[model samples]
Target: MPGVEREPEGAGSARRSLAALLLSMGVSAAFAVAFIVVVGLDPGITFALLAALLVSAASAYRVLFGSPRRAGGITVGRTVMAGALATLVVFGAIQAIPHGRDHTNPPVVSEPAWDSPRTRELAAAACFLCHSNETRWPGYTNVAPVSWALTDHILTARDTFNFSAWEEFPTSARLIEAAIRDGRMPPWNFRLLHPEARLSAAEKEELIAGIRATLGG
Candidate 1:
């Protein structure tokens, strides 16, 4: 019993190190989900980024501790982490920039050219998504980083010509007609999801004429 040997101190250090790494990985994972849920970020992207973070942190730790089993893996992991972090930062900044507008259930300030039923229908179908207070916000709108882009587009569109505040802004009939004629107002991206917004040539002409008559172009 007197000659029994004790395990080396290095073994204890290695065990502690592994425990610390595992704890860190668990914390990072929990935070990642919290970030996605709290901010309403795209879950797929967030999970992918979280995986990258775990891989990178693990690899970096291995490399620093002189584990040469997969040196190249460590390099790749660091690169992925850097790129992902940069992307997240840029998207985060965009989201943080307030456009000084709130998406509220505000009272309708004015009405558009309701001279004809079809005219009203066209406006409701195509222009309401971004230009009116009755925006039917899509599920995707809640998910960033796409949400950031969508919000910015909506704010800009409203600022240029808000149909809800038709009287206050008083947009010209000619401009409205031109926007539809040139396929500009309801941009292509918008039409991708809302096929109803994609007006045919006849429909466009009818809408334009209605706008001209109603708004006195």
Candidate 2:
């Protein structure tokens, strides 16, 4: 070929930017997926985590493509990346604590003499996972902090009133009736995750009435 003007070496930076941008996106996306898998659906903490992730991603984008001005001795981009890396390390280390990964469902020694089959069905559908021996642990319950929270909640619920262990039922029936009637049995967060626990007006009424009849309100 005839001698022609060669492209400048700086032109390679464009290709570098493109590759780095894709890598940034891939890393961010992978972190997001892993975060959810590890932390489950805690709205507050998740939102904060995502906000930091967004800031880190934005800073990375600016460094890769936009003009990243030096602020102090180091740039803000590196600071954010360092903070995020530290957070990941701390969370990763938390997994080794082994506090709440116990998915043990003790034997169903007894059960309440449910007023009717429908009552039992309703209870099982809405409240059993946390309040009974037959809990079907979800995937998030296998992780660390999320597992800890869920395990604590479930244990507390069972202690309060376990339908599967009705042999030791230790509360007044009025408490049960009030819990259902006041729309407090299924907390908002639980309903957010469990659609079946989102009872309709009629269903709630029926369940409430059934609990009273079964437990002697």
lDDT of 1 by residue, 1-217 (tens): 5765997546655555465556666766775766565443457766765666566655555554455233322233343454355556545555564542345545678876578988878888989888877787657575555565566667677778788888775688888988887887777667877899988888888888888888896
Rate residue 51 of model 1 by lDDT: 64
lDDT of 1 at 6: 90
Error of 1 at 155 (Å): 1.7
Error of 1 at 14 (Å): 32
Q: Rate the local accuracy (lDDT) of all candidates.
A: 0.67, 0.71
Best of the candidates, lDDT: 2
What's model 1's overall lDDT? Answer: 0.67
lDDT of 2: 0.71
lDDT of 2 by residue, 1-217 (tens): 4575786555555555455556656766676665454334455555565566566555654564455333312343454565466556556766897878888899897888888999998888888998899999878788766787688778888999898888785556788777877777877667878899998989988888888788786
Worst 10 residues of 1 by lDDT: 68-77
What candidate 1 gets wrong by more than 4 Å, as runs, is 1-102
